[model samples]
Target: MAIEKIMGTETELGISAKDPRGFDPVSGSILLINAHRPIAEVKSIWDYTGENPLLDARGFEVSGERERPSQQDNRTINKLLRNGGRLYVDGAHPEYSTPECTNARDVVCYEKAGERIFELCLASANLSLPERQQIFIYKNNSDGKGNSYGHHENYLVDRRVPFDQIVQGLAPFLVTRLIFAGAGKVGVENGGERCDFQISQRADFFETFIGLDTMAKRPIINTRDEPHAD
Candidate 1:
């Protein structure tokens, strides 16, 4: 019998502040995440001891420096929720990563819960700001500019399965499923052909068949192998 798949999702939300002094997305994101008060008192510090983002599944380490935020910055940016989910800042966006779930229904529930959590945080953060300088959070992936953030999905697959076989099986499905699953965009981006509208917010960003880069020169099959579990 096939093993039951444990799945989760990570969403990087778009953020901005309506400030006359000019907006700083990173600062706004940090403020938004830090304002949240989790129901249970849990350590906000994220343990990154075993994380190796540079280690690619192709048996090579990528050339890049791993992020090492100061302890104060880490505390201000990362939050551990009572529901076993994570809320943090990723780049200029505030992100929420859902806890592991055994089924799609549970994933949907958790994702909705995350939205509510963000709303709560937004209200809390806005209380300290003037009405004209309030921060805004968007669930969309793109900011209508050249930049695109990630709405990544994670699935637990058997390590015994060949990577090539897995890619072959998944790539076609991911490509075709965009027709029905895409969030729908109003305009093209990332140097894509001139189109007034498109299906997937991320479709225009894929530039390679396989690669480890997530922000730039993205790949159809990302080779990052950090499974977040042993």
Candidate 2:
């Protein structure tokens, strides 16, 4: 009898390197963040700062009274914004915890992944443009010692399509254990067989990795604009 060997294959989604889904850079609204594995490896930015200014800004910014977004838009962003998102981690970070993030103008906390690394959550008043781009470093060892990796990406999926279909197609891409868009920490695992090995370190899995990009400069629109009548 001949034995068939099943060798493991290494996938190159290149998530840790950069955003794979690719945004329009102008109209892409959905963005993927790895909140679990911030470049600095800091814990809970919301608690660390003791205030959430971005959240408070909603009343004054965007629209008065925090104009509730369309059900679809709200639902999509809610997943990414879950747990407060005050920490500024990756959504597809592979970690389960979301860092209890929050965004408010009055209660703002400018903190970073590393101790005194630098505040990175609110570079913009509208919760746009992260403050610290250095979080990709991953390690506080800045002197040749600077750990590698510090980037987050966002995808703008077309709302017309069903979320489940997207998940199914995307699953194959993630099966190899990629970071959604170039943000991985643990390269290799030391437990069980490779087949059973699952990616670890996701902060807000659904929200960060896969959510609406309404705030995107232009947004990655996947809807059909054939001028359909209601």
Candidate 3:
């Protein structure tokens, strides 16, 4: 049986606002998120009622409590674009989540379009900044420091397939496939170890085999059971 191929992606671009005093990424992210607000054709709040970060994919609840997205997030920083995509501030970074795409080509088009949208936003946002202050955005995942951003992808799987089977079949590919799929990076070093380059920037950061947490102790298999079906 063939499964319908539905896909989408979310990218968090690294941003820096530099001035004579210092640099602020939080302010830069906020500016980029709000850049389209003034000219937005339709403003729709993200409905968070269906969100359940605590529900595990393994069919049991997690121990820690789920924290609802704050009211400030809905009112201030989130926007549903006219192109059907979503732009919002996630943590200290501005994230662009592409609308549902049916095939690989459309997915690529939408992802590239996201970068153009950010470029336009940055151009608009910079006009309001001081002459000496400027904002720069990078599509890369890491900040060269210990912190890292993400390029998250979503897919729709047939409900007929057992979840455990799905995980078992996909684990090896997800763990080792980075050899060909990784975004190339500069050299890296930890303690006395050093390497010229790495396959995936986020690979070395995984601390556990399964969990719902994304920032700390990131799991190879994300257990969060948020429904992707619409």
In model 2, where is the ten-residue run with the lowest total lDDT?
Answer: 6-15
Candidate 3 weakest lDDT stretch, 10 residues: 184-193
* Candidate closer to the true structure by lDDT (higher is better), 2 or 3: 3
Q: 67-150 in candidate 2: lDDT tens per residue?
A: 334555433332332223332222222111123222322122322322122123211221443333212222210112212122
For candidate 3, the TM-score is 0.89
In order, the Cα lDDT scores of the candidates are 0.88, 0.28, 0.80
Q: Give the alpha carbon lDDT tens digit for every residue of 1-230 in model 1.
A: 89788999998998877863788888899889888977667865888777778988877898888878788877788998899899999888999999999999999999999999999999999999998889988888788887888898999998889889999999999899988898998978876578998889888888899999988899989998888877
Each model's TM-score, in the order given? 0.95, 0.21, 0.89
Candidate 1 residue 221 C-alpha distance from true site, Å = 1.3
Which ten contiguous residues of candidate 1 have the minimum total lDDT?
37-46
Mind giving the per-residue lDDT tens digits that candidate 3 earns over 38-136? 454664688788777888887888767655667776756787887878888888788899999899899889989888889898998989988778788
- The reply for model 3, stretches above 4 Å from the true place, is 20-23, 37-40, 63-72, 189-192
Best by lDDT: 1
lDDT (0-100) at residue 48 of candidate 3? 80
In model 1, the runs with Cα more than 4 Å from the true position are none
Backbone atom clashes (below 3 Å) for every candidate = 0, 60, 0
**Candidate number with the higher TM-score (2 or 3):** 3
